[model samples]
Target: MLEGKVAIITGAGGGIGRDIALLMAQQGAKVLVNDVGASLGGEGRNAGPAQSVVTEIETAGGVAAANTDSVADASNAKRIVQNALDAFGRVDIVVNNAGILRDRFFHKMSDDEWDAVLKVHLYGSYYVSRAAAEPMKAQASGAFVNMTSTSGLIGNLAQANYSAAKLGIAGLSKSIALDLDKFGVRSNCIAPFAWSRMISSIKVDSDEQAARVEKIKQMTPAKIAPLAVFLASDSARDVNGQIFAVRNNEIFLMSQPRPVRSVQRSEGWTPQSIAEHAIPALRPSFHSLDVSADVFSWDPV
Candidate 1:
């Protein structure tokens, strides 16, 4: 589907990103597999993971190059794109999947933890996308597949930082789709329910939780690659700025924020009027404070 294209996939060392890189290459795209090789907490780095994936690709008769660069840094992001250009001469697809987890309750979260997640997920996405925007504009065609999360789309406990960043990525993807439409650039997001290093961190304290974890385990990271490949290819040129979720073999077109209910007064709302009139009028439509798991309660199919 992506014949002759050059794709840069950040976080391609393992998990979802690794699978996407492999699939992209198999589809005839020359891939730049970028991974800082950071641990789950965003500490330490090694080149082995990225290099190993590249070797796997080449051994399978696909084209790929390994890059160990931090997407959290603006300069390194540009160089990542540059590395792709140097390898294959043009940029066609970008999958912003690089991320780290630093889970802590909101009240107990530290400044560094917050900053670290935002820097790698939200800011990293922006920096890389911004750097690639010009090149894609010049070429008059491009696609972006950003990694969002249900944690942000719905809610999650003790992931204030991650939820904020993932939700920000959704908005960022929409903004990019709107801003770059004229340049023929498309951006979309995926909220994957896959079992990876990130999801493996979920604290399970009961038998019920353990069963839920087993269900999640069936939804492997590989399940996410096909949708990402489609979004990054011309096949989805008409599908831009949409959010999707994948669970096992099921794929969902998730809804974006839109007005479901509204209440108005000709004289405009007052504190007293809002309490008596508007609150009651809109009460039925108010969303619950449910977490991601609550909303995605059905067993993975």
Candidate 2:
């Protein structure tokens, strides 16, 4: 579906990114696999992960190049895009799948923990996408598939940093779709339900949580690649600024933020009036403090 196209899949060393890179190449996109083999907490680096994925792609009769640049830095991110251009001539797709997790309760989270997570998942997506925007605009066509998470869309325990970063990515993607649509560049987000290195970080403290993890394991990283490939292909031209979720075999067009209920007064209301009248009317529309797992209550069949 992506014949002659060139793609950059960040964090393409392993997990969901690796699967996406392989599928993109298999579908005929010359892929630039970028990774800075860091641990889940965004510490240290090795080139083995990226180089290995590149080798895997090449061995499977696909075109790919390995890049060990960290997307967390703006200059390195630009270098990543430039490398893709140098390798494949013109850029066509960018999958912002690079991420790290530093799980901690809000009260106990450290500044470094917050900054490190945001720098990798949120800023990294922005840095890479900003660099690729110009090339896509110049060519008058491109697609971006960003990885978001239910942790953000719904909620998650002890993941303030991660949820915030993922939610910011959703907004960034929407802004990109709006800003680049005129130039024929499209952007979308994927909230994937998959068992990967990222998900392996989940803290399973209860029997129920363990069972949930087992169910999640059934939805492997491979299940996510098809949707990523589709969103980054010409086939999804009409689909822009949309959020999607992939579970085992199910694909969902997730809902975006929209006003569900409203209360208005012709005359300006005071706080007291709002408290007395609006609060009662709007209470039913208010959302509960439910986490991702709570919202996804049923197992994916």
Candidate 3:
């Protein structure tokens, strides 16, 4: 479906990013696989992962190039996009899947942890998309598949930094969609539930927890790639600013942010009036503060 397209997939060294890179290539998109090859916690780096994926694509008779630049760095992000333009002459799709996890309770979270997570996930998306947007705008055609998360969309314990960054990404994607719509560029966010190196680091405190994690691991990262490929294809030309989730074989179209209820007084709301009238008026429509796990209670399909 993406034949003749040129795509840049960040964090394509492994997991979901790797799967998307491979699928895009297989669909005949010339891929620029960008990966800093960092560990799960955003530590260390290597070029092997990126190069290996490039080799795999080449072996499969697909065109691909490897880039070992940290998406967290603005200069590096520009270079990554430049690499794609230099190699392919045009950029058609960009998948911002680069991320890191620094799971910690809010009270225990270090400044470094928060900064690192935000830098990579939020700022990284901004930098890469910023660099790619100009070229895409000039061409008057492009698609962006940004990675968001349930943790951010809903909520999750011990992932304040991650949740913040993910939510920011969703907002960023929406704004980008609006900003680029006239240019014929589209942007969407994906909250993917897949078994990857990042997911493998879940803390299991008991046998049941281990079993659950194992079950989760069965939802291979590859399963999430098809949706990304679809979103990046011409088939999704009219789809923009939408959020989606992929769990096992199930694909969910998440509702965008909108006002559920409103109350008005001729005088407008004062604190006392809000507490006395508006709060109660809007109570029925108020959503509970449920986390992602609480909402997704069913076993993976």
Candidate 4:
């Protein structure tokens, strides 16, 4: 389905990015493997993983190239996309799967820790997508799939920064999809629950963590790759501005708010009036806007 396409995959060295890149290439897309080889916490690195993937793809008779540029830097982001264009004649798909985790409780979170995660997960995607959008716009056809997580959709202790960035990715996806639709470019997001090197050696501090890890362990990162492949394929030409959660073999279409309930005041509006009349009925449903629906009816299906 991805035949003859050129795809740029950030953080393609390993984990979900690696899986997505290989899957797209196996489906016949020439892939650009971009990875800075940063550690799980976005610190330290080696270039081995990035180069290794390129070699593997080449050995398998697939067209692929390795780029060690950091996605968080705007210039490096453009350089990575340009590298793909230089290697292949054109660019068709971009998968922003590069991310890092800096976990800490809200009270104890350091400014550096918060900034680091935001830079990678939010700004990194922004930089790369901005760079890729130009080529996509010119081609009048392209797909952009950003990696998000359930932690962001919901909430997870010690992951405030990560969650915020992931949620921001969803917002970015929707906005970009709206803007790029005129150019026939699609933007979407994936909230995947999968196992990867980042969490392979992680130590669970409690039974809750153990249970959470066990639940996610059942969902391999490879299972999530097919959705990405589909999104980048021609079959998804009409599928844009959507967010999907991939776990195990199941693909869950996430929900968003769409003005489902707007209880206008029969009485004069005031904080006191809202608290008295609206609070009871609206509180439960208001917060439920975060995630509750088959798929958001914001626009079409």
Please provide TM-scores, in order, for all candidate models, with all chains considered together.
0.99, 0.99, 0.96, 0.92
Deviation from native of the Cα of residue 26 in model 1, angstroms: 0.7
Give candidate 3's whole-model lDDT: 0.94
Error in Å for residue 259 of model 3: 0.9
- By lDDT, the candidates rank as 2, 1, 3, 4
lDDT tens per residue, model 4, 149-235: 777877656788998999999999999999999999999999876788866745798996686667667667789899999999999
lDDT of 3 by residue, 91-178 (tens): 9999999999999999999999999999999999999999999999999999999999999999988999999999999999999999
Q: Pick the candidate with the highest lDDT.
A: 2
**lDDT by candidate, in order shown:** 0.94, 0.95, 0.94, 0.86
Worst 10 residues of 4 by lDDT: 292-301
Q: Which of the two candidates, 3 or 4, achieves a greater TM-score against the reference? A: 3
Off by over 4 Å in 3: 206-208
Worst 10 residues of 2 by lDDT: 292-301
**Candidate 2 residue lDDT tens string, 1-301:** 9999999999999999999999999999999999999998888999999999999999999999999999999999999999999998999999999999999999999999999999999999999999999999999999999999999999999999999999999999999999999999999999999999988988889999999999999999999999999998899999999999998999998999999999999997999999999999999999999999898889887
